[model samples]
Target: MQILITGGTGLIGKQLCKALLAEGHELTVFSRNPASVPAKCGAGVHAIGALGEWHPGKTFDAVINLAGEPIVDARWTARRKQVLWDSRVTLTKELVRHIATAGRKPAVLISGSAVGYYGNRGDTAMYEAADAGEDFAAQLCKAWEDAAHAAEQVGVRVCLLRTGLILSNKGGLLGRMLPAFKLGLGARLGNGKQWMSWVHIDDYVAMVLKLLHDSFASGDQASLALASGPYNMTAPQPATNAEFTAALAKALHRPALFAAPAPLLRLAMGERAGLILEGQKVLPGKMTAAGYRFQYPNLDDALGNLFGR
Candidate 1:
């Protein structure tokens, strides 16, 4: 398969590209800095500065839309929010537009969404069937998914991967937390009762492969209908914030002796703190029902695999 990926330099995109390349798939990393793909994704893969840079005759078997600004990197100021919105909502629209005009459309468009679509549900468990909330994150995901679904009108199969917290040693949430945990400064956020739905990066990448392969088999309406739309790319088992903190502390042989109060977090991070203090217990109902098996179903195994504990 020849796959075109946006945000190929991101944590998940980098690993996904490496894995797909190893599987004998041809790749093209679409980026603002095409030259950086060689340093980030290594050789053999093609890189184009923009979709416009591609020759009119060039096409792809699949287009994975993963380009988006990091939501949690900064406090949710008006400017920051616009950047986040434009990166995802705007960029995805452009990708879909290109697909609409392409001489040869891709078989499937695997667009990125997030578990944040459900909003801060406290301890409530969320599935693909759940109605989305009205928060900024949820609204953002809805718009993002809407843009990707436009390809379906052109006969391209669409998969909206509502991914959870990706746990990997290479980078992402776990990488950012490791130094503090290793230094014994790790602490629970708020009361630590909020549910955190997560997946091992390896399993997350595998889910994409599963969906990509399944698209080929989704010839008739029945098979195609069963596989498309919002798939919660999360583990079967969801953990509370307290359980996750304890497990990380135990894995690192460090003491989780402090608790960061919710009020302080809100004060420090403003609205962005809601992402840390409030979470949904998302379940991969559709993905699992479709026969995708998880490599690390439990938090312990996932942490162990990443930290070598």
Candidate 2:
């Protein structure tokens, strides 16, 4: 299989590429800066600029789109919101247009979405069947998935991977939280009751490969791939914020410090604070029922695997 990934230099993309290559699959990393891709990726790499600038000459077996701006890195000013919106929604829309009109459409397009599509649902458990929230994050995912679905018109299969908070030492939330945990300054935010859905970086990549292979077995219908627009790419079990905090601290052999008040987080992070302070109890009902198995289904096991005790 030939898998082409956008944002290959990113944490998830890098690991995904490595795993695919180990499995004897060919790879191409879509990049704005071809030089940004590491030398170690070897001969499988093929750079075609950014998502918006990609030219559709060579059709791939699969195209995994992970191109997007980090949402939590900056304060959510109007400018930041626009950047987030354009990077995911707008860029996805352009890529779909390119694929839909291409001379040779790929077998499958595995585009990245997020559990943020559910919004801040408090303690409510969310499945892919649940209605999407109307906030910025939810709306962003909604638009992004809608755009990716346009590829169905061109006889191309599309899988919307509504990814969760990725648990990796390489980057994402864990990368930011590791230092504080090492210093014993880590604890839950607010009441620590919000449901937090997460996925191991290993299984996350495995699922992408699974979906890519699934599309190969699927034929006779392009829209069949878009049959499930928002598959919850999370573990079977959802943990609370407090559970994650306690497990992380225990694994690191550090004392859990004082809780960061929600008010303080809001003051410091503005609207973006909701990402950490509030969460939806997302379940991977669709993915599991679709024949996918989680490598790390529980928080303690996931934490131990990533930050070994």
Full-model lDDT for every candidate: 0.90, 0.82
TM-scores vs. true structure, each candidate: 0.97, 0.93
What is the C-alpha lDDT profile of model 1 across 39-139, one tens digit per residue? 88869888988777655477888999999999998989899999999999999998988888888989999999999999988777788989887899999
**Candidate 2 on 1-309: residue-level lDDT in tens?**
767788777888888888888889878787767876656355647666655454567667777888889988999899999999888888888877777766677878889889998899987889888887888888988888888888878877778888998999887889998899999999789999998898998888888877777777756354354334667889888889998888889989999877999999999999988889889999888678777878899878888888755
Give lDDT: candidate 2, residue 156.
74
Against the true structure, candidate 1 reaches a TM-score of 0.97
Q: Top lDDT: which candidate number? A: 1
Any runs in candidate 1 off by more than 4 Å, and if so which?
218-222
Residue pairs in clash, model 1: none
Which candidate tops TM-score? 1
Question: What are the C-alpha RMSDs, in order, of all predicted structures?
Answer: 1.2, 2.2
lDDT of 1: 0.90
What's the C-alpha lDDT at position 239 in model 2?
Answer: 85
